[model samples]
Target: MNKIFAKQFNKRALAFGWGMVMAMIIFMSTAWFAFTTTNQKISAEITSLSILEDYYKEQDRLIAYSETSSKLALSQSFYQLAKDSAIDITNSCKVINNVMVWNNNCHPNADFVKQKFLEYYDTNFNSFMLEYPNKMDITYTNVLENTTLISRASPVTFSSEKQGTFAKYNFTYNFEPSIKINLTEQGISLEDFESIYNKILECNKKIECFQKINLENWDISTESQGSWFLFKLKTKKPFIFYENDIENYAPIELNFIIEL
Candidate 1:
């Protein structure tokens, strides 16, 4: 009986030891699984952050490029040439109108009128060409139909309560002229033109700057003049003579009319 009891006790102790060993193995396996899962999650988050950083960096580069392109386009020689030409034409028209009305006293002779117009053209047009020598294929056409004259009146205040009216002698004679601008030999390519136009649009934020302008109702032919574009503009505006405040107000509503 004693031997049998001893054997039963040893068997129970072995079974308990085996159960503890199994429990320890299970706990270690669970801890290892949890650690691996957490590590993988951290690695995935780090990778995602890296991807986002790269994306934003690329976006910044693109934005910088876009801005640079826009600025370059606005500063292009072609754009400057167009703007300067327009300003010159407008100023020349105003000068000629003033000369015809004030200098000749509205009774300009044929020779006087022709000479004044020629002088104004030579001075301004020549200056423009000299500045932009690369721009070739310039054609000028002057059409004289019936001279259309414009007149205006100014209100005169007599006293503190009474109002008076006086006639201010001002006139604008209408003339149609066709102008052609060519850039075929300016070392400019179609791709460059397109890029410049695109950049202009981006900077201006509107299509108005790129739209076609007509000074008067004249037939404009761009292709016939070997120009990239051609248009007819009417030269007309009010001529005002101010002796005292000549710089304050000289010519009003002067339009040199340009088509491009």
Candidate 2:
């Protein structure tokens, strides 16, 4: 009886020790990820938003390319780009949100969208086309920003497989996503950025244009809370005189996703 009791005690002690070690490891990892994650996210958002300019140019090119070709061919190109982009952004958001929640919301940027955002993607979004390996499909402008979606579409099929009668597709393309804001570079805290991100869904629900966020005939109300703003764009055609109309001035027509 004495020996059995001692063995049981020893086992308990060992398990407890391992549990403590694992706890420490997790704490350490969370701490390290928290360190300057804000700065890292800031850098990531900047790089992503900056890429939208190139995307707009690409959109123009796509439009022009479609005019010369059949709509079916044009649509294939668009679907390829959209599918590739959406999956990429969804993946990036998932990873970022994971890191953020794990790190206690260090710095919620444009990428760190709604809490249910990733959950929605997991339920609704599918990988573009998994025929090509991820490597041949992506190019990284910022290596540090290479969290997966950070790598732009390379669109190359390296290898493919064929079964007895059927061949499985194996290419990767994440439908891209990036939102553009024409507002001036104002001094907003990390919390403010987080607040606007959270409220975007709330405000966007009523406005289809803002929901798609085409940034047309719209102006963001700079009032109250100082942390959040009401972004409004006229939906009707009968020209109502607003202070800052979408047509009065144009900064840049940027394309971005609202997670849906």
Point to the candidate with the largest TM-score.
1
CA lDDT, candidate 2, residue 99: 21
TM-score of each: 0.31, 0.18
**How does residue 154 of candidate 2 score in lDDT?**
34
Candidate 1 residues lying further than 4 Å off, grouped into runs, are: 75-260
The superposed Cα distance between candidate 1 and the true structure at residue 117, in angstroms, equals 31
Q: What is the C-alpha lDDT profile of model 2 across 1-260, one tens digit per residue?
A: 99999999999999999999999999989888886575666655555555555556554543343222222221232222222222234443433212211112232353533222233322222222222222123331211121121112334222322222122323222333221211122111113334434555555533444344332223333222232223322211122111232222212111222322
Instruction: Report model 1's TM-score to 2 decimal places.
Output: 0.31
Going through the candidates in order, what is the number of backbone clashes in each? 0, 22
Q: How many angstroms is residue 141 displaced in model 2 relative to the true structure, after the best TM-score fit?
A: 38
Clashing pairs in 1: none
lDDT of each: 0.34, 0.34
